[model samples]
Target: MTHPFPPLVEAYLADLDRALEGADPRERSETLAAVREHTREALALRGSDDDAVRHLLEELGPVDSIAAAAAAGTPAPTPASGPPLADTLLVVLSVVSLVLFIVPLFAVGTVVWAGTRLRAGAGDRSRQKTALVIGVVALVAFLAVLVSHYVATA
Candidate 1:
């Protein structure tokens, strides 16, 4: 079995292929491709050593579980989609507010709106957090400018 992949990887793939038997043709191929791509990426990043390959296989989990998921018509979860549109919009608005720090009211409003939405668990956590951070920075900048102006006038 002198294949390009390590022996462990080869065995794992073989077992997965067998376990996937009776699965839909398209699903089976897609599953195989996803597994292969994952393996390739891991090997490239972690090296092809036995220990690394063994760990990678562990992370992939048992081939039986994967086959079971496929049989159940739930393709293995993959990072195929981006954040929701609302989340993206929040992030964009946050950035815009940060850039237009002169508009202190708008920046403060954006921060409050983003914070409220985040607390309600309305959208993706990461994007909401990003929006919050940017909004806070904008608020801080605006406050500093206001203080500096008052001090200079006085």
Candidate 2:
């Protein structure tokens, strides 16, 4: 049996999906579903052929242009508004924790909080990951220094 979506149509959809990757999930799904439905309707009316699919995709315009239009229509908040609060806090705490080993418990708390936010996708993922890395490295170095100091004194 012929597939519901022709190979050309499938390729077009894949291109659209790639273009829409940065869009919100709901918007991306809605856009893709709408395009697929329109393609099916056109196929039904014009006959399921390569030429018809190509014509339809051409009329729809390039996928990158469509994505650009969608992104322009959407109101994405600007990073200039301020850095993400949780990520900023994570970085600060990581630095503080490194400088003041007297509060290892608090440092652990910061790591846990950053990890939670990272898992939840609540902050800048890269920033959170960097903060966690720095925190972990600082913690390890602090412990090593303490062990060496005690051994030397003994």
Candidate 3:
């Protein structure tokens, strides 16, 4: 029988499901349902499952981008903000950072600077904020070492 419908629909769904496999249960479920719906309707209308699948897959392109989009739907926080609270940890790191050759101080300074920028809400500049935080921490530690070393030697 001639495929009254396009095959791309099924292809699109298959790609979507494949991409969704590694996704969270909630996301997988949602995507599964949505993709199924789209495919079912398309195939039913065309009366050709295989053709519909192929056509859909061809038009939808790769599944990676779709997976990325799905993931982006709920963005993850930056590494700096994630975890055991860098704000407090940074102060400690600053001290540790200074113990060795003042390099750590520079790191501390960068971290602090980044944190400040973040607080100011740079909008799309969150990455900059993170870098600034690290930089502040490093810089502060470096300064601490410099001051200590100079005073100790002099």
TM-score of each: 0.50, 0.46, 0.35
lDDT order of candidates, top first? 1, 2, 3
**Model 2 ranges off by over 4 Å:** 1-82
Q: What is the lDDT of residue 14 in candidate 3?
A: 69
Q: Candidate 3 residues 35-93, lDDT tens each?
A: 55554544443335465456545544566766775666653221122222444444445
Tens digits of per-residue lDDT, candidate 1, 31-105, equal 999999978866654568888788778778899999988888897754343556877888888888888998876
Candidate 1 clashes between residue pairs 3 or more apart in a chain or in different chains: none
Better of 1 and 2 by TM-score: 1
Q: Which prediction has the highest TM-score against the true structure?
A: 1
lDDT of 2 by residue, 34-130 (tens): 7777677566545566776777677777888767766666532211324467688888888888787655764686678778877665546777887
**Lowest summed-lDDT stretch of 10 residues in model 2?**
74-83
TM-score of candidate 1 to 2 decimals: 0.50
lDDT of each candidate versus the true structure: 0.81, 0.73, 0.53
